[model samples]
Target: MTTRAFCLEPEQLDWCARLRTLAAERFRPLAEHGADGRLNRPLLAALGTERGLLDRVFPPDGTAASALDLCLLRESLAHGCTEAETALALQGLGGSPLAQFGTAGQRERWLPGIAGGRTVVGFALSEPGAGSDAAALELAATPDGGGGWRLTGTKTWISNAPYADVYTVFARTGEAAGARGVTAFLVPGDRAGLTGEPLEMLSPHPIGTLRFDEVPVTAADVLGEPGAGFGVAMRTLNLFRPSVGAFAVGMAQSALEAALAHADRRTAFGGRLRDMQSVAHQLAEMATRTEAARLLVHAAAAAYDRGDDGIARRAAMAKLLATETAQYVVDTAVQIHGATALQRGHPLEHLYREVRAPRIYEGATEVQRSIIAKELYR
Candidate 1:
């Protein structure tokens, strides 16, 4: 199985090469089955644990990784398996707050299970009214008499919610509305008064709304300082946003490959589809945009890896460009395939849906543009 080559540093390139081999050997066979929407919980857990894919990229020991290396791993995984990619990404994001600010006991209790894939994790920060405007979260977490807290309200569009054992959830802790008053908590799935219902969507992933009604949480669940949930969320987003772009890069790369393959073999007007100037131009545009997006994504990752203070703005730009460009590239690939791309089980169709979610999650493209503009003006 020949894998695509990405321009990266020697170590980064080697890591990606190994990742591709692993994905081909393990994740490829599982991708389609996982996409069936039956929620293959045990299979996903076993795969993640056996391969150590989750632990390798996101170690709990505070070991630092290059942004480029992180992007390479994610991009490779996404190219071969969106389900695996989704699984790994959620683990990292869901557990990141704990890694970043949890008490030692909290980290010890949760990190090992997540690393071993024995437990799944989720981040539930998006509320019905707080998708892009995270500061508008209405869920309340008031202190209970026994030094614990009672949580009330709902979180919608939560990824990996149905299958996750734990979630890093945010709720209001202060009277000052918006970002300043929010606090983060680690909510275990089996806790009483907490319920989740799976949401069906165009894409096949475990997403749902979580309703918390007088759900009790101990002080140990608090992540970071009180009233610091917004910042913690922002910090996590800064790190993971580039991976979202990497996902786009992977999708676009797949689309370009499909387009090129079809253009070479499909006959049209007494010659190959590639012979047509229109087809050739479209392919060229797709390749160019894909490469450009790749560069931006990696560049942002590199900047973050270097601990650059300007990483937020750079990451936002990368996420914005890569996601929007991926949408275009995949749409063009579908166009080039004509009717074949529309088939229900075609890879292109899956890529189409997979490419869209990145645009809306993390931060919408419009939200990214605003962040970029704000940083530029500042």
Candidate 2:
């Protein structure tokens, strides 16, 4: 348990352990005080104030981490508090395009809020009809002819939607089919005709649906080449997919630990649960799968960091295996703990809710298979 994951150096292990301590001692209290299924400003402020984590999300040079470093940060934070890890992850997700592609003024306006944990940022890409099939998104961006555009569409299931300070929005700006018509825009939350309502969801955080009724934007808001925004979106997802797996790995590890602790303590049939062959075998399965998932996550992250070919395939594999494994591990942990784990306030219960969504979001399990298959033939 003391050794760093993936054979990380001692200093790295120590930092992760420190993050876990912070999560249990500081972050957990803040998380507990926040409203369920809503933005937690105080928790965010706490994260912003934590210089070590804040810097991880926004490095001093204002550049982002390699995929491996991102995985480490996410895995460590998730081990302690999934809520804290998610907040940090969302900041990176929503702020990524801005940090990498925004105009100087755009970055100046929003980056500080993001880095300081004072601003919530949204990645507004998914639409009601088009999700995994991102290229088919139909949010229209009509040209106003004066170098601006009027956006008139709805984006659903966006994280941090209503409350975000700014959004990295993708809208269709051309008649070309598929991803060609899309463009990325930096849209401020306060823009005219832009509104949102929170969506009650299985996984808690700040998730909502956004309406852009002629929301106005100028050329200044464009994130990249006018019609190439899909690339921007894909690149961002590619960078994050491995870290998402890392998050899953952390959750699995947490579940395994809980199960191990319970198995050693809970007696059944005149012996501890750990002594029972069935329980021991289940534990073995969970631990082995979790370890294998972690290796896939790290390898995928390393592939991204190296800028290697077939990155899409690698990322898909990582996310696919790790999330599925997490679902199994967490479920097994709950089974081992029995009814106590099902209580609303129980850690396993919370994890049970949290673990189910990663399979559906980002990219579904089926979608990952398609990506891998396409790569295989290509």
Candidate 3:
């Protein structure tokens, strides 16, 4: 039997050990319940507020956490609860810019609730026409005469849009037409004319589209400089992209575990599945790819923590490799499990669906390739 090896520093290993215990004790039950279409929001809220997991990676002090710490927590949480992983990840993503650049008042108003799980936060950048070409967004934010802004446009494929209390929304600030015109706003979900509708996905979560018909915002809500929305969004992605890889690593780890457990117990050709050279080779390959992906994710996280400008490139690399590798690993696990993997409620089956979205989100594989090419040529 191949025992999964975690590649983490000693301190991160300790943190992961604690996080795993918490996941087993708390999140696992919720995850099992959620499997039957029961999403326990109150339970998640309690975990965030009472258990203190939301603040694990994003501390109150604004000091950067080690990349290993972030990866450890993400992987551990994802192992037991992907919805909780999604919720926690969005908190980090939504509040990250504020942590990086918000005025004290802005941070005071939002960060605590986020850390306490009193509210949900979302990032709204993609539009009907602007996904991979993110800079081509057409959402307009015109300055209102009363010293505020009136946002008008539609954003699609927004994560957490259906339940978010606040959104880090992006829109056009200039007529130049491209990345230059983009600006970001901290739009309250309850603001007038701001509405969202849930989007059904292959793997379910609180994803949706956000519509703004003159949604209002004060200058106080602008995330950074008016023309710096693209930078903020990209910088935020650079910081969290490795964690996406970490999510993939976690899913892959679960799949590998399921496969190995099945292999050890299921007999075939007068021996256990683990005795077959073909199955052992496949398991070896899956393990190798998963570990390699973890290394890439950690290296990118470490680079960001060290304040290295190379983080964007490394993050893109990690996101690309880890998500694709996760797809491969999960598919192999499904094959190893044979008919059992196809059963609707199987853990491997769930992982199969969960692993598909990471490649599409965070910036698709093609976008990452372009990013790598551009960086290499530059």
Candidate 4:
């Protein structure tokens, strides 16, 4: 039998440790002081300019960061501060299409602000009717006689919406049906007739709904070709999905650590909680599942960096296992901690809220399973 061991190099491990320290010492304070459910410009500027982490996503050399690098970045930061992790991830997600497909003028105009963290960008794809079925987006982009388009529709559940400096907006252009007719545009948030309002979400990240009333966009604003936006979206998602799993793995690891620590110290019936069979077994399960999810996330990211075949299936599996595992581990940790875990400011409580969204965003657990199945048969 051949045994394959998955592991990170000593240097890579050290880098991750440094990232955790940076998040705790530098980013967390800013995140705490910032308003709830809103963008924190100071925290973003630190991640972008001070730490230069955003440069890894939109490098000046035009070389994209490896998928493994992105996964490591997300996981390490998530372990120390989920808010910081979320901010960094949102920057990368919103700006990646521009980096990958924008014209030179677009890149020159927007890349600097994005890297400096002065600009907030949103990926406006999910409409009220098209959250999971993205191809079913109903936002319309009617053509004008002068090589321009007028957008008129709504996009909900958009991160950094209303406050974003710009948005990568997708709208139906009538070239065909479903995804075939969709187009992506780089629309400024201040563009005429563009408006939005913040949403009060469970997770405290800045999410909102955008309403467009015939917002004008010229041909120069298009990302890639007009009818090729879906490909742009898919490529961006493929690169990001594994990192999302990495985020979940980090949260699971944090919860597992808390469970282990609590088990060792807390007193119960005649002894410490670790002495109890039920508590011990629960800790073991949490540890085992967390480790499993971490390894799977790493494997998927490695596959993506290598440009291996069946990336879609691997990415979906990684996200499915890791996010689900995070939810389970966090819930079990909360149970072990008893009433204290449910307190308003408890770490586990915050984690419990944060862990639920990953399974729904990017792609849901059900969606991931479907992708895996389709890929297997293909």
Per lDDT, the best of the predicted structures is: 4
Overall local distance difference test of candidate 3: 0.82
Candidate 4 runs further than 4 Å off: 1-4
* Residues 86-130 of candidate 1: C-alpha lDDT, one tens digit per residue: 777778888888887888899889888887878878899999999
What C-alpha RMSD separates each model from the true structure?
3.8, 2.7, 3.6, 1.3
Ranked candidates, highest lDDT first: 4, 2, 1, 3
TM-score of each: 0.94, 0.96, 0.94, 0.98
Instruction: State the lDDT of candidate 2 residue by residue for 77-165, as single tens digits.
Output: 78878998888889899988888888888888878888888888989999999989999999999999898899999999999978888
Clashing pairs in 1: none
Between candidates 3 and 4, the one scoring higher on lDDT is 4
lDDT of 1: 0.84
Give all candidates' CA lDDT scores: 0.84, 0.89, 0.82, 0.92
Tens digits of per-residue lDDT, candidate 3, 1-378, equal 999653556776787777767776777776666532223466458567888877765687777655656676788888877766776787778777777767788889988887788877888988889888898898998888887778999998887776788888988978356787778788788989999888777755667889899998888998888878888899888888899999999889888988999999999889999999999999999999999998889888877888887677899999999999999999999999998888997888888888998998879999999898899877
**Backbone atom clashes (below 3 Å) for every candidate:** 0, 0, 0, 0
For model 2, give the 10-residue run with minimal summed lDDT. Answer: 49-58
lDDT at 89, model 2: 89
TM-score of model number 2: 0.96
Off by over 4 Å in 3: 1-7, 34-40
The better-scoring model by TM-score among 1 and 4 is: 4
